[model samples]
Target: MTITETSDGSITIVALCGTIDSSTAPELHKSPAIADTLRSVVIDLEKVDFLDSSGLGALVGTLRLKQEAKAAVLLSCMNPRVRKVFDITGTVKLFHIFDDTSAAVEYAATHNEG
Candidate 1:
């Protein structure tokens, strides 16, 4: 799996590609980019091909971390494959999900910080 980070002002967008399973979830957890985000963060799973329970756990944990830091964590998930993990785990409702990157970024811009 690969993770790339980009910024729209203080809004940090983390884009993921490849599968996120038990083996790869730890890399995501250890990524320093998440901590580098300031007011807002968005996980863009546009290129993610797969997600499992462990992957779902990683996302939830990350979200909780951001929330504890008073930072908004949005998700841009258009892939049905990745969506299914969140849906099946009943975690989709826990986040603000956008169909595309621009919408997610807009949400972070308007709702996240001052």
Candidate 2:
């Protein structure tokens, strides 16, 4: 997977492409910039084709770390298959999920403003 980050002060948007699995999840989870400076993280998954247990675990782990830092994490643009995996694993309610990047960014902006 490839991760590209864009930050506008308080929120950081991380656009992800390709599959997120056991091999790629570690790199994503260990991003120092994202782990440290981001008050909120928006993960854009529009180009993701697949995800496994490790991928979901990575997201959950990141969310937990963000929460520990008193921040938030949002997920966006999940395909039907990925969404189904989240639903099946009952992680859907654990995250702030959106249908598109704009909505996730908007949510982050609004939350930051508040």
Candidate 3:
């Protein structure tokens, strides 16, 4: 996976491309700038085509981790199949989800502290 970031004040937008599976989950967890300390985080999964159990685990862990540090995690553009995984596992309710990155970014900006 290729993870690119865009910074808007304290809100960090992480755009993830390619598949998020077991092999990539660890990489995402250890990504340089996507720390749990950020006050606002928008994880753009628009380009992510697939997300497996491990991938879901990583995301769940991220939300919890960031929240512990007083950060809010928002997910954006989860494709239907990948989204189904979240829905099936009841993890969809755990995050603030949006249909696109723009909304996520906007929401984070308004609701979070820089």
Candidate 4:
């Protein structure tokens, strides 16, 4: 998978591309873009076409870490495939999900007080 980032004030938009499975989950978990727990993050899954259990785990792990740091870690632009995984796994409610990246960024900026 490919991960690219852009910053909007203290909020970082992490745009992910390609597939995210066991092979890429670890790399995604350790990605520097979302590693900074002090800053709120918006994970853009617009380009992610496939997502498996491991990929979901990686995202959950990120959410946990950000929660520990008292920062926001939101998800946005989830395609139908990715959204289905979250829905089937009953994990969609765990995150602040959005249909638009800008909305996610706006939410993150306002919520990232830590």
Candidate 5:
């Protein structure tokens, strides 16, 4: 799995690519960069091809962390398969999802500004 982070003052976008499974979930969960950021987190899943239960757990854990910090975390650009998984698991309702990078950024900006 690959994770990239970009921030524009008020929001932090974390773009994820490749598969997120049991083998790689720990690495993502332990990222200090993600843990330390207080701004809202927008997870871009456009390039992610596969996700397993471990990945789902990691996401849920991350969401909990964000809640604890009083920060927002959004999931964006999820492909059909990924979206299906989230839907079946009823996790889609737990996050604010966007269709693209621009939309996610705009949503974050507007929410943060208000």
Candidate 6:
């Protein structure tokens, strides 16, 4: 999987491409932007082709970390397949999801408390 990151104010945007399964989940966890609990984060999944349980776990873990730090973590541009996983698992309610990356970034920048 490919991960690209950018920053705006206190928000960091992480864009992911390729499959996010067990193999790639660790990389997601190790990402500098994702690991930084002090900054708000927007995870852009526009290019992600597939996601499995491990991927979901990584996302949830990130959310938990951010919550502990009082930092915001949102998701953006999730495709139908990825959305379905969150829906079926009832994980959608746990995150603020946006159809647009820019919107997510804007929201994160404003909502960030850390």
- For candidate 2, write residues 39-92 as lDDT tens digits: 688888888899999999988988887777767789998889889899999998
| lDDT (10s digit) by residue, model 4, range 7-75 | 888788999999999999998866776788766889999999999999999999988888889988889
Point out where model 1 deviates above 4 Å: 37-39
Assess every candidate by TM-score. 0.90, 0.89, 0.90, 0.94, 0.89, 0.95
Over 4 Å off in model 5, which ranges? 112-114
Candidate 3 weakest ten by summed lDDT: 30-39
Alpha carbon lDDT at 14, candidate 3: 89
What's model 1's lDDT at 33? 61
Model 5 lDDT tens row, 17-97: 999999998877666546864667788999999999999999998888777777777889999999999999999888889
Q: After superposition, how far is residue 111 of candidate 6 from its true place, in Å?
A: 1.5
Clashing pairs in 3: none
Give the local distance difference test score of model 4. 0.88
State the TM-score for model 6: 0.95
**Candidate with the greatest lDDT versus the true structure:** 6
**Candidate 3, superposed: residue stretches over 4 Å from native:** 112-114
- Give the worst 10-residue stretch by lDDT in candidate 2: 30-39
User: Model 3, 7-89: lDDT tens per residue?
Assistant: 87777888899999999998897675566565578899888999999999898888877777777889998889888999999
The alpha-carbon RMSD values of the candidates against the true structure, listed in the order shown, are 1.9, 2.2, 2.0, 1.3, 2.2, 1.3
